[model samples]
Target: MDVFDRMQNGYLYRPEDPNLGISNTEQLKKQRLFNQTADHTILKRMFAAFGDGSQLRPPLFSVWGGQFVEVGRDVKIGPGLTLVDDAPIIIGDRVQIGASVTISVAGHPVDPTLRRRRLAFNLAVHLDDDCVIGDQVIILPGVTIGKGAIIEAGSIVTKDIPAHVVAAGNPCRVIQQVQVEKVEPKMAKSEFEKMRDGSLYLPEDPAILAEQQIHMKLQYQYNNLEPGDPKQAAMLKKMFADCGEECYIEPPLHANWGGFHTHLGDRVYANFNLTLVDDADIYIGDDTMIGPNVNISTAGHPIWPAYRLKKYQHNQQVHIGKNCWLGANVTVLPGVTIGDNTVVGAGSVVTKDLPANVVAVGNPCRVLREINDHDRQYYYKDRRVDLDE
Candidate 1:
């Protein structure tokens, strides 16, 4: 069988097969434009089945340029969305997706021999109607979300979620039964005012976008053009509203307002690929060390599909206290506050506030332990803490 047929039927196949990816150059062009501009017309022409009143915030990442994704009517998705659509990704009507969510339809075998041959398989992801997928959620291959299911923040869904249930966690499970009421969102203020006040705003509003575009251009230049540019300081000043002295961020930084909504205290250091979805204020205190691939977001959306279909958005401030260390791949959600001298472990998702002088870690991050005298005595593996030595 051909690679496509094999993938559709859930059989192993080689990804390097010449006939696999989209041969249609026109679709590729549209995909590029859609990401660059968030243009609905380009998105409509790119996907397999895009229905009426559907809205997607762009920078949409897809494997095959949305060729295998069939999106139903009134579906709304937020920014930093990734669709690994090697097989079909079928979305039913009124699906609400949050920011930085990934729906991957492809998986690899565990066997080394199978992997060595560049072998992979595909199983389609199906999202039934009226489902709410929260921020930074990852849905794996062959999973089906039942109608009206609600997956909360920072969930990694590995299996099917039944209808009308609220599910969340590392390997996501049903937490409770919740039927999200379809309440009509109020007529929000001007987009900028609504954004700052944590009310539902549209990211695609013309005036809002016009102002955001200026910062986005600077952000693009900072990420792409300024690899070795010595005037990184100047660029950073232009990017952020309040960038403190001795603060350094490694390149490939992604920000919604180009860090204009963010304020940093002194001696703050961030590693590569720190993404700031700074729709609102993000205050980082002094001496905070952020590890690689950290995502700090201040943007969110309403759970109601009707609100989402209209592409309503909201923002909340994030506050990080002084001397805090966030480990690699930590996702800090909207409206979170991390206390001073706290440490978040690797791969943790901070969905709530963390108190000072503690180590918090998990999918929905919780305090592991307080930073007690044990920490003062031993730094690493019973090694004595000798400052003089």
Candidate 2:
């Protein structure tokens, strides 16, 4: 039998076979695009079988790509998602995967001779619907995670985890059975409200963590883009929830949500090292220009040290109005707003709202002067505008 046929039958086969290598090479190309592309729907097309509304967080390392992968509806996978999909990987509906989770289906033979010859076997991994896999969890070959199961963070799942149980630890075991509460849909607290209401909630909650992972992956792809690539602008538009026309941002842009929580208006230009702490919405109006090392934050934590251990964070929106210019090394704190036609001088820290038509400077930025006729005549001090030219 051919190598592929042997692989299907779970028999020993040369992984380095020429035909297999070619097939793998092609899949790798697709996999690269799959990981880097802003569109998650492309992943569904790449896999052997995929259900509707499934999304894979990028930088998703995979062996033999998605050739043997099968996913069900609404499967949300987090960043650093590694799948050794040499064998079948069947993931069911509504599976929430946390960041840095590894799921493998391929294993090497214990025999020395087989190991020397670079031989391996694969077993299908089945994750039933409504399961949650926590961060940094490693799921080994042939493991089955039952429906509604929860695998805690930093766990290594070596065997099957039965339905409706919470599992944790290395070589993970069942910690406890999850008691099902039949609460009304209206009574259940939404994740968005839990995040925004300043309430102490689980940041590592599968749904929330999955969103974080997706953002990180998209940011990774954006950061790695070569300068002058035609796809850069298009990719950015797709990555962000709202990016207006003619907006340009230099490389090394950092955001917690990969600009997903950021809204930029038309013709906004940001220099390098523009860091956005966009936990909540950050709005920038049209024709705004931001210099290097600018940090605009919307996320803040509690003052109590003990509360910090629980990783509780609160978010507030930051707004910058139209035609503003923020100079280098400026930091805008949470809940701050800058008004239209404003200028924030270099190395300024904006902690409070600044009104329109002013030149602001320094830490805890204050208005130095409002826009006047003299300011309009000169671009800088004594630099007269060549209006005739």
Candidate 3:
């Protein structure tokens, strides 16, 4: 099959194909204009299929210009939606999609050989009518969500869900069966509810924006202070959800929410340029030393191009155990866990979980070896560690 046919058929194909690149660029350009303009009339003319009374908020990110995306009537979408529509995305009537929600129909092969060839695949995603997709939810390829389903915030949907159920958690599962209760149209949902419940809510809400502004000022103050500031520790404790004693994060630390969602245990030390994309909770255990330029990200987007164009995103927590050392330029993706006493080599991209007391390295980081007796005697291959000071 040709590349485009393969994509539609869910067969692996090279995404770097020149034809695909050209198509992607054109789609992105259209999406850019769609996001910039406020006129609903103009947006309706751009999509492949847009139903009556369906409106998507601004700052939407998508792929393929919604050519393979279809939206039903009277659907209200929150900000920062992302549609990765390599295949097809079908959203039904009266749907409410929370801010930063991602729905994708594309995925990379797990096989290293195939992945190395830049191979990818696409599958269709269908969200039935009257569905509520909470904020920061990721709907993967080939998943068909049933009608009247509620996908809670921060969940990752990998499989099909039955109709009329509330699903939640990482690798989302059915939480409870929901019953439709008819009532009068209520007032706009509060930002706190959106953030707390994981539904798409407006960040532009004055209360929410005000809080963020205050946090930014605090971050600026922290970044500008000298290394010897006595009040630094107190500042950190106040800014974060929970921060333990003797923790030192080097200056120029960057966090999207000013580390408000992060929790650091005792005696943690992070070097310069430690960037935390802390849209959700991040827990770091005691004595974990983070090296320079380390990035820990909690946000992820769907594989579907249509979802990306809508700017939808999800956030997952990251856990790092005690006494671990993350080497320079290490990048940690969402929902990864690293066990205690582990050493990650420089420039490693941690994609999965790692157990304690091992040395891991490389892209999609894998365990090279267990920490053995040799490490005790030699610092670096015959360079003896002189502990007798």
Scored by lDDT, the top model is 1
Better of 1 and 3 by TM-score: 1
- Model 3 Cα lDDT, one tens digit per residue, 241-355: 8899999899898988788888999999999999998876789999999999999997777688987776656667898999999999999998899999999999999999999
Residue 66 error for model 3, in Å? 43
Residue 350 lDDT in candidate 1 = 97
Q: What CA RMSD would candidate 3 show? A: 17.7
- Decide which is better by TM-score, 1 or 2: 2
User: Comparing 1 and 2 by lDDT, which wins?
Assistant: 1
After superposing candidate 1, which stretches have Cα over 4 Å from the reference? Answer: 22-25, 179-195, 199-389
Q: If candidate 2 were superposed on the true structure by all CA atoms, what would the RMSD be?
A: 7.2
lDDT of 3: 0.83
State each model's CA lDDT, in order: 0.87, 0.83, 0.83
Model 2, position 247: C-alpha lDDT score: 91
lDDT of 2: 0.83
The residue-level lDDT of candidate 2 at 263 comes to 93
Distance from true location, Cα of 348 in model 1, Å: 40
Candidate 2 lDDT tens digits, 144-213: 9998888887899999999888899998999898875621111123344456554544566555666678
